[model samples]
Target: MRGRTLNDAFIILDEAQNTTIAQMKMFLTRIGFRSKTVVTGDVSQVDLPKDTKSGLIDCLEFVDKIKGVKISNFDSSDVVRHRIVRDIINAYDKRKK
Candidate 1:
């Protein structure tokens, strides 16, 4: 396995919408030396209980303050899904206010 070393690896965590705040913190700590984390989840699609806090939700503020963590926010304009998807997203946004 000496010559089988991998140069790059990509780790993607799906259904991250279901992770609790504590689990998210534990997973984030597992990042390897040369590995990077791409944590993607839709807050609007969170599956956690109404009173539960999502790791992805709480980490945003903490990650933003970290020097190397990168945070990106995509809105309706960035929607690449079906047009109806964007419309639904917009509709929800309107109702949240």
Candidate 2:
């Protein structure tokens, strides 16, 4: 993942919240011509060290103003797991506020 470029490929990076700022930048730069990349993460569920900044959150801030970048936000209603999962997410979200 260091020096290779992904060309004409579809790349998906899951759990992006676990990545560091520098890692996200490196991953994004690997995209080459005709490549489509998707990064998915739940900022609320980040597992990085407490002092570390989440790359997903950082990327969102910078890419929001860039052209050809689209961001989609989903709530607990989007949870497709067991019904209890959605309830749990909603409970935690409520507690956060």
Candidate 3:
């Protein structure tokens, strides 16, 4: 029963700013059998208040060694949004220097 058999599924979590550390762990644990998940978020763009910790940031700090989890970093150069966005990011970088 090929059609009836359950197959692995792919899921992508984008703009996961509202998730707390606990929520992230729960979501990761809820993956169905034979499923893969990819979670992506920008820590800097977090909409949560500064006092609130983002799951994405927590995961990055603690889950790097977890099996099947890969961490990749993107900087201002990866900005693919409006031209001014990249420029603004670059300008901020210059200000820090």
Candidate 4:
């Protein structure tokens, strides 16, 4: 990760919540000069194994307090889909618990 350098690149990592913590650390450390990275994922929705820790959740714990990193969280109010979609999501969440 440290061996390579990316300059002026915009890196967007999707489905990052499924990544392992070790992989998240590697991706973060790979940032090079003038590179901007956006790691977007819902901590509540992880596709990894049941016992595995989400990389997105773990990474947020470490970098959320950093000065340059900005973390934005969206709720159902921000959902762009129909209301039924949000309700379906809520139902799934409820079922998980």
Candidate 5:
């Protein structure tokens, strides 16, 4: 995803919370004509070094205002996995606050 542009492609970057700022920018800029990109991450679960900022969080700060860019947020209620998964997420969320 460095120098090549993705054309007519569907790219999904999962676990993006681990990406550094520069890596996120590079992944986003790789989008080309007729391509759709989806970046998924849980900010609370970011595994970057303490001093490193998460790219997904940084991108969300500005992408909402960009045309054709859609941001969808889902809570525990939207979890499609087993019930335990949603419960786990809820527990973590509660602890964060």
Candidate 6:
């Protein structure tokens, strides 16, 4: 079946930390017309194989300079979850350093 164009829509991609750069490119290329796409992930908490690089990380490092692009880096303070959850996230984040 032919795929319909994603025109005049807003798309949020969750759990994108496991996606490779190629996959992210393919997904972004699917957008059409006035669509807005947001790809989100935690680079420090990637679950992919040890040798793999996250697409989200690549974009964070390289794509921000592109015109009309916006990147929002959320911190533990941005968490709306229970206090324990935020603490757990902060703990894990610290372990990565």
Best-fitting candidate, scored by lDDT: 2
Better of 1 and 5 by lDDT: 5
Q: For residues 1-97, could you state the per-residue lDDT of candidate 5 as single tens digits? A: 6789999999999999899999999999999999998889888889888999999989999999999999988899999999999999989889989
What would you estimate as the lDDT of candidate 5? 0.92
The lDDT of model 1 is: 0.79
Off by over 4 Å in 6: 1-5
How well does candidate 5 match the true structure in TM-score terms? Answer: 0.91
Q: Residue 7 lDDT in model 5? A: 97
Top model by TM-score, which number?
2
Q: Assess each prediction's global lDDT (C-alpha) against the native.
A: 0.79, 0.93, 0.77, 0.86, 0.92, 0.82
Runs off by more than 4 Å, candidate 4: 92-97
Models sorted by lDDT, best on top = 2, 5, 4, 6, 1, 3
Q: Compute each candidate's TM-score over C-alphas.
A: 0.83, 0.95, 0.76, 0.85, 0.91, 0.82
Output the TM-score of candidate 1.
0.83
Sort the candidates on TM-score, descending order.
2, 5, 4, 1, 6, 3
Across 1-97, the per-residue lDDT of candidate 4 in tens digits comes to: 5577667899888989999999988888888788999988987779899999998988887797788999888876688989998898788878989
lDDT of 4 at 83: 93
Worst lDDT run of 10 residues, candidate 6, spans 1-10
RMSD of each: 4.8, 0.9, 5.5, 2.0, 1.2, 2.3
User: What are the per-residue Cα lDDT tens digits for candidate 6 across 43-81?
Assistant: 767898889888877777877888978888888999998
Worst 10 residues of 5 by lDDT: 40-49
